[model samples]
Target: MKLYYSRGACSLAAHIALYEAGLAFRAEPVDLKAKTLAGGADFRQVNPLGYVPVLELDGGERLTEVGVVLQYIADQKPETSLAPPAGTMPRYRLMQWLAFISSELHKTFSPLFAPHTPEDYKPVIRERLAQRLAYMNQQLAASSFLMGEQFTVADAYLFVVLNWAGVMNLDLTPYAHLQSFQKRVGARPGVQRALQAEGLLGS
Candidate 1:
């Protein structure tokens, strides 16, 4: 497998997923702003959406989207239990959290990264993020991860998106549980490896 990623992008989640699964994979850096891959290949051809977090499977099948890619990697190594077994309640619940992050938390922050985002929109976005984060904190208060004591794919996705707090200058001081979540997820060997590989960490 090969993962195309840009430093600190959501692709970091996918990169970490592969590592956590003990999967052998190659990292191909993408210049997201330039829309070019490591080999000078037009990234548009790899993923017309021109986004980071594209994974090329061993058979040459390409997977785009972080949520899907993380799930795929987890499914590849079920023993890792990054996601619960398919067709089970735990699996569906994991999917539920993934969908929530993708639609609510992830897309909600999109405007904050936009060059033309209106000044007035910032507070509205921050409010929504805070509300969603509060709900998450309450839900996670009883468990170590979003799904419970076990670390799962949902944690990875949430951790990656939540890391954007710095990008948006959203202080996390008030979210204690969420802050703990960050520390827990960051301490994982695989996540640390991913961060180091992305140049976001040092050995």
Candidate 2:
């Protein structure tokens, strides 16, 4: 498998999952802004949407979307337990968290990153983000991870999204549980490897 990704993007979640699953795969860095690969080939040919986290299988089939890519990786190595078994309530709970992270928390951060986003609307976005973060903080307060003690793929997704707080200059001081969650997830061997592979961490 080959993963096309932009450093520090949502794709990092899948990258971390791959490492956690002990999967063998190659990493292909993408220039998202240019829609080009390291070799300067058109990335649009791979995914016309021109986004990262496109996972190409050995047979050349490709998977898109962070949530889908993550689940695919986890399913590949079920013993790793990166995700719960399918059709089970625990699996549905994982999906619930994935949907919340993708729609609620992830989409809310989009406007803040846009240069054309109105200055007045920025605070409104931040406030909305805070509300979401507060809810997550409460959820995390009850468990070591999003799905209780097990560090499922949902945790990987949340960690990557929360990482945006720093880039956006959004203070995370109020989210103490999230701060500690970051530290806990960051300390994982697989996550550290993923971070270093993407140059987000020093080797």
Candidate 3:
């Protein structure tokens, strides 16, 4: 499998999942802004949407979307314990957290990264993110990870998105539980490997 990604983008979440699952895959860096691959190939041809985190399987099947990609990787090695067992209550709960993070927390943070983003709208988006994060903190306060003591794919996705809090200047210090949660996730070996690969660890 080849995972095309832009460093530190949402793609990192899927990349981390691959690492945690102990899956064999190749990484292809994408120039998201230029819409080119590392080989200078037109990226739009690989993914018409020109988005990063495009996973091309050996047989030519492709997968996008960070949340979905993480699940796919987890399923590749279910015994690795990256995801809860399928068709179980924990799996459904994990899906709920994934959707919450992807749709509510992750998408809400997207506009802040846009060069064309309007300054007037940042505060509105920031407040909404704060509310969502508060909910996450509450959920995490009672569990080691999104699904509990085990570190699953959901934690990987949440860690990637929450890392952006620094760029947005979001004051997570107010949410003690959440800040601690980020620290725990960041310290994981797979998380460290993913960030190091993306050249984001030292800075």
lDDT of 2 at 126: 94
Candidate 1: lDDT over CA atoms?
0.90
Model 3 backbone overlap count:
0
Those runs of model 3 whose alpha carbons end farther than 4 Å from true positions after fitting are none
Can you give the TM-score per candidate against the true fold?
0.96, 0.98, 0.97
Residues 1-203 of candidate 2: C-alpha lDDT, one tens digit per residue: 99999999999999999999999999999998899999999999999999979999999999999889999999999999999999999999999999999999999998987889999999999999999999999888978899999999999999999999999999999989999999999999999999999999842
Q: Which tens-of-lDDT digit does each residue in 1-203 have in candidate 3? A: 99999988989999899888888999999999999988899999999999978999999999988878889999999998888888998899889888988899989999999999999999999999989988888988887788878999888888889889998888898788888888898998888888998899976
Candidate 2 global lDDT: 0.95
Quick one: how many clashes does candidate 1 have? 0
Q: Candidate 3's error at 34, in angstroms?
A: 0.5
Give the top-scoring candidate (lDDT). 2
For all candidates in order, the CA lDDT equals: 0.90, 0.95, 0.89
Clashes of each: 0, 0, 0
Residue 102 lDDT, candidate 2, scale 0-100: 97
Residue 13: error of model 1 in Å?
0.6
Q: Residue 49's C-alpha lDDT in candidate 1? A: 90
> What would the per-residue lDDT of candidate 1 be over residues 1-203, giving only the tens digit for each residue?
89999988888889889889999999999998889987888999999999988999889999887888889999999999999998999999999999999999999888898889999988999999999988988887888899889998889889989999987889888888999999999999999999988888742
Model 3: residue 167 alpha-carbon error in angstroms: 1.1
